[model samples]
Target: MPSAFLLIGIPGIENGATWTSLVFCVLYVLAILGNSALLYIIKTEESLHTPMFFFLSLLALNDLAFCSSTVPKTLGIFWMNGGLIDATSCLTQMFFVHCLSVIESGILTAMAYDRFVAICSPLRYSSVLTYSLLRKIALAILLRAIALIFPIPLLVRQLQYCGDNIVLHTYCDHMAVVNVACGDKRVDNVYGLVMSLFVTGFDLLFIGLSYSMILQAIFKMPTKDARQKAVGTCGSHISIIFIAYFSAIFSFLTYRFGQKTIPHSVHILSSNMFILFLPFWNPLVYGVKTKKIRQRVQRILFYNQSTFPPSRH
Candidate 1:
């Protein structure tokens, strides 16, 4: 077994690594600050303690995990040529990246269901998504992600890596690592495909169905203002959903099919962008679209007062 694998970050863009690293560094800092502030605001504001905000907090945390898992080493490779990642560390990173990806899909699905309940079945929203049930849903998301992704790294470990230990991407992506192993990779490939379809396909199907129901309910509302209000409520989540899924699908497709036609730099860069961009964008989208979160964030930054006024006894 190889001791450590080398990550050739953006193979053809070595000359521009300084600029690339700088851009990635700025984005990483922004993603961290944005998600941290989001988590903080959601945590402190009592009024924001609803099921929607609870799921947003989970998304923020997942974004943080997603970026932190890959960006530091990517920066190291880009700026300082530190691409060495040991077998265990690489597997650990791969596990978290893929696992959190699945979790994000699950969270988005849950949020869609939350919206469906709120817009389609308004009377039962609170009763259906009580905190107890919310905790259970969150736990299930975590468990399902782990159950699906845990076998991937194990499969990689079993393969004999007799060839070069250089991975042609920024992080220990499952297929990327498997490609470097000198063993039959059909099992790994099939499992990855099955898991991807099961997670992404399944989650997207439900999300689509939920939004279909939500749109149906919105149009049935008595007035245009009511329909607009319903859409307004879901705008931030829809923006986030698009950002997360679109970038992910683009990257996944490019890796699986565009390998021959797409430039290596494009592949590596897009993958990094997918991992980094969503975290940075999540807080911005929510803060700008969600009225309460926006006001609370503004107060935190521009004023020294608490997010909400204190309660009188």
Candidate 2:
């Protein structure tokens, strides 16, 4: 087995590694703080203990896991010039990164279903997404992600890497690692394509369908106020889904098909953005858009003020 792999951080901007490191560091900090705060607020707030908030909490955890999978090592290379990763370590990182991504996609699908139930059958929403059912959904998402991704490291381990072991991206990814292997990687590529199509692609399709039904239901509402309220509830989720999937799909397609035409820097930056942007912004989007979360976050941040409001007596 190859002992270690080198990560070639941004090709052309090699001299600007410090600047790149600083920017990523800031984003990582924001992601960590934002997700942590969201989790804390969700866990502590009694009124936000429903299925929707429960799923949002899971999303916050996923965002944390997803960003943590790669950013630290990426920062290690950019900040401290530690770029080499052992074969086993590289495989571990790739496994978690891909697994968390798949899990997040599944969670997004579940969230879409939650919205569907809420808007389509308000009376049945609680019964449909009870705590027990939510637990099962979460467990199924985890199991499916693990089962689908379990083959990746095993398949990758069988490859021969006689060529330069330099990964041209910021992190250790399946494609980036596979591209370096000297052996026939057609199976690996095919498996990846199949997984993407069956898993993430299916989730995106279902989310789209869910939203279509949601819109149809909202339009049928008798009053504009009711329609706006329904739309408002889904707005944050829609924003997050768009940011997450659009960036992810864009990066995936660009890596697979735009290597020749797209600028190297653009590809590298977009790939990083795909992994980092959603995690960094998801909490902010929900915290600002969801009134309950925003209020709880405010209370958490300014406990003293909330504890003792200005004297009106």
Residue range 48-144, candidate 2, lDDT tens digits: 9999989989998998989888888888877777888888898998899889999989998999999999999999998889899999999999999
Q: What's the distance in Å from true for residue 147, model 1? A: 0.3
Q: TM-score for model 2?
A: 0.95
Per-model lDDT: 0.91, 0.88
Model 2: lDDT equals 0.88
* Per-residue lDDT of candidate 1, residues 1-313 (tens digit): 5999999888887678788899999999999999999999999999999999999999999999999999999988877889999989999999999999999999999999999999988899899999999999999999999999999999999998786899999999998999898889999999998898788889999999999889889989999999999999998888888888888888888878898999978977888888999899888888888899888877777675555588997
lDDT of 2 at 286: 86
Q: Which runs of model 1 end up more than 4 angstroms from their true locations?
A: 305-313
User: Which runs in model 2 stand beyond 4 Å of their true positions?
Assistant: 306-313
What residue pairs are clashing in model 1?
A: none
TM-score of each: 0.95, 0.95
Lowest-sum lDDT 10-residue window in model 1 = 299-308
